[model samples]
Target: MSEELGMREEPRGRLYRVTHRTVYEYDDDVTSSYGRGFLCPRDFPGQRRIDHELVVDPEPEDSSTGVDAFGNHDLYFHVTQTHRRLVVDAQSTVAVAAEQTSWANWDDWADWEDVRLRLAQEPLVRQYVIDLDPPEITDEVLRWAAPTFAARRPLVEVVAELTHRIYKELRYDPGSTTVATKVSEVLAQRSGVCQDFARLAIACLRGHGLAARYVSGYLLTNPPPGQPKLVGADATHAWAAVCFGEDRWLAFDPTNNQLVSDEYITCAWGRDYADVPPLRGVIYSEAKTSTIGVSVDVAEL
Candidate 1:
């Protein structure tokens, strides 16, 4: 169940197209079930635009799901259960383009200051800013041993090193925390999933006079030996993206202990999960439980 799924797209001239599908099935004979799904968010730079459609079988059914247009992302959710069966399908065609063509320098904070001000005005994003506690950059944490990383020991370097150290100090336990869990709780427990890790990183980065946000998306895995291509499997993932300088936001995945490469498929970016839950909504069902299944396949066109 903990396997890393593979998903890769082959280029066709200057463009690459990717399609993603997800299905959820429930067998628990409960009276109801609830679920949520996310849509194409603005942070997915390579994607041009996205369209979504919902299909529910039978004429009159007691089920409800819709998209939340708050923040810079869109999310949808629903709750209900029928004795017969229930199925939800979401499909999207993502258009890929060349990478960002700009380089940012350290002294460009003036340019990013505007962006920071704008993001801080949003109600959802403002909450993250208010919630973050200033990180205690102690000499002990700063002096942690890492001879290989000694040369890059400026403030930015310290932030990166501390964040990486925090990731290493924490355990990757998916069930240890939920979306509603607080960063303080995760820090205290020293364990959590990708979401928790991402949130912790963002908070820490922002604490150090840097702009960082939560990135919800999929991680493209390396194909096993003899496998020709990569494909995504049963779950969506999350990470963090820190604004290095100016408009430049570089991604870092502490869960996997790696830098963002061509394999990271971005879906959305915001201060935290509340701004971009892959899927969320209101449901009319009196009682409910839910399950999710996702798969991604990438191949040469």
Candidate 2:
């Protein structure tokens, strides 16, 4: 699918009513299915999830909620009843903080190299800061990110420039790539959706020995003047966050070429897309074909 969600929002802050609906249609009936969703917004420094609920059609035989290792809300459910389609609807009321004034103080931070070495000794930050999978460090990624890692450059400044470079170079074509597309491929193709850009950024940062993680969320969108924002027109969005030693992880939206602010609503994050897909499931079916449809609506509340 389509990755879109969020309402018209202001930089100061706003509470939103978010609804995300996903439907899966299979050619043959699916006797059973086990699914997971990372649909709950996280409570962080300036963001708070007030209330949330998830509904599964045909009612699941069993369901429970828990927090993932990365601290995201993870929901698990299984359906035993035979069905040709499955629907998951998630709704939330979230209060997002205004853009932080602290961003302006980034210039006073330690150099990129210092932050890298600091995180290197911190065992807990290893997994996210290091490239362990498809977004492996390649010469190509290193070359692309080299310019941003100049000596003594403030860590935040380096990432901000890198984020700018990616946004300027990559084309956001929905069908150009899939969830399986690797950062190396994205580098060669120079195009992809939010997820692709996010992963690419993660690789680039890790290539330079910085800690970065993929973030999944919703972005408030604006329609052209005189046009109504269509329901489901907005899809889930993705971005990247880089650690600056200590407990700080600054978020960047290479997809939109901006630092994350109140306009962004974070849901979950992990090493990459595979770690936290909005919705994924295993189904037992003879169907040779399956199609997914997603709809999202985010209205100011």
Candidate 3:
């Protein structure tokens, strides 16, 4: 559903070259269009940004590049030329972040409830964990996440446990849900794509009064054994990151059921998918419909 949502858009243990291309075709001429997105990879802690570039077809009359409130690089553009097709191409070279996550290392870690209490006083992380809009957190969501937030369990442990549970129980059906699907609906359906899974995990954390964020990026997907890797076969990936305290965060991929490592690249992170989608735009035209296609490739260098 995320890919269909808007082909949302990461590896650093090793240097990587990532290419993302989005093409829009309109049924009739479009007089103007305005777009905003995260085309350049973010320079987060433990991550290195080597080089990056973005190209817009039809040559936008106005454009700007800057960092958003979340400190991620963002691009804004407006195309005024009359055209039937528009293209956005972004290429980035980056060295990925590598972090080893252990399940048995909780000696000094605070309890899940303790972390939640600490977060209640934090304003910096509140932006990422707040779930007021769309009503992602509900009674049902809390009830479903109740078992995982056990009494005095470590925060990271609770996060990882939910990650595994989602991966094991829910099916990864591409079309199971849509961009508008809520966490409650996803919980009831029991299946969805990366965005849905990531959102669900985030809802669980917020229900416990913890701060969790939605991550958008690219993941390296392998081909079947003995088969050549297909160019642009890799997809835009997503995951959830739980803020244990003000100083640290642990990210987990529920769809892949693992701790994020060098294989995943960081693009932009926000409270949810709507905040940092790869590309979203508004067009002024008489065109009745439009089609979008996104192609992504992650090559290790």
Q: Write the per-residue lDDT of candidate 3 for residues 1-301, one digit (tens) a residue.
A: 0111122223335777888999999999999999999867877666667778888999999998878888888899999999999999998877876765555553436899888888878888887667857588999889998999999988878887999999987888887888888889898989898899999999998877889999998875554478554222367888888887755888888987878877677899888888899999999999999999998888778
Q: Write the per-residue lDDT of candidate 2 for residues 188-300, one digit (tens) a residue.
A: 99988888888888898888778899999886655447855422238998999998778778888888777886767899999999989999989999999999998877776
- Cα-based TM-score, every candidate: 0.62, 0.90, 0.90
Residue 109 alpha-carbon offset, candidate 1, angstroms: 12
Best by lDDT: 2
Q: Per-residue lDDT tens digits of candidate 1, residues 117-160?
A: 55555544443344433333233322332331333244344435
Candidate 2 has an lDDT of 0.82
> Distance from true position, residue 36, model 2, in Å?
0.9
Question: What TM-score quantifies how close candidate 1 is to the native fold?
Answer: 0.62
TM-score of 2: 0.90
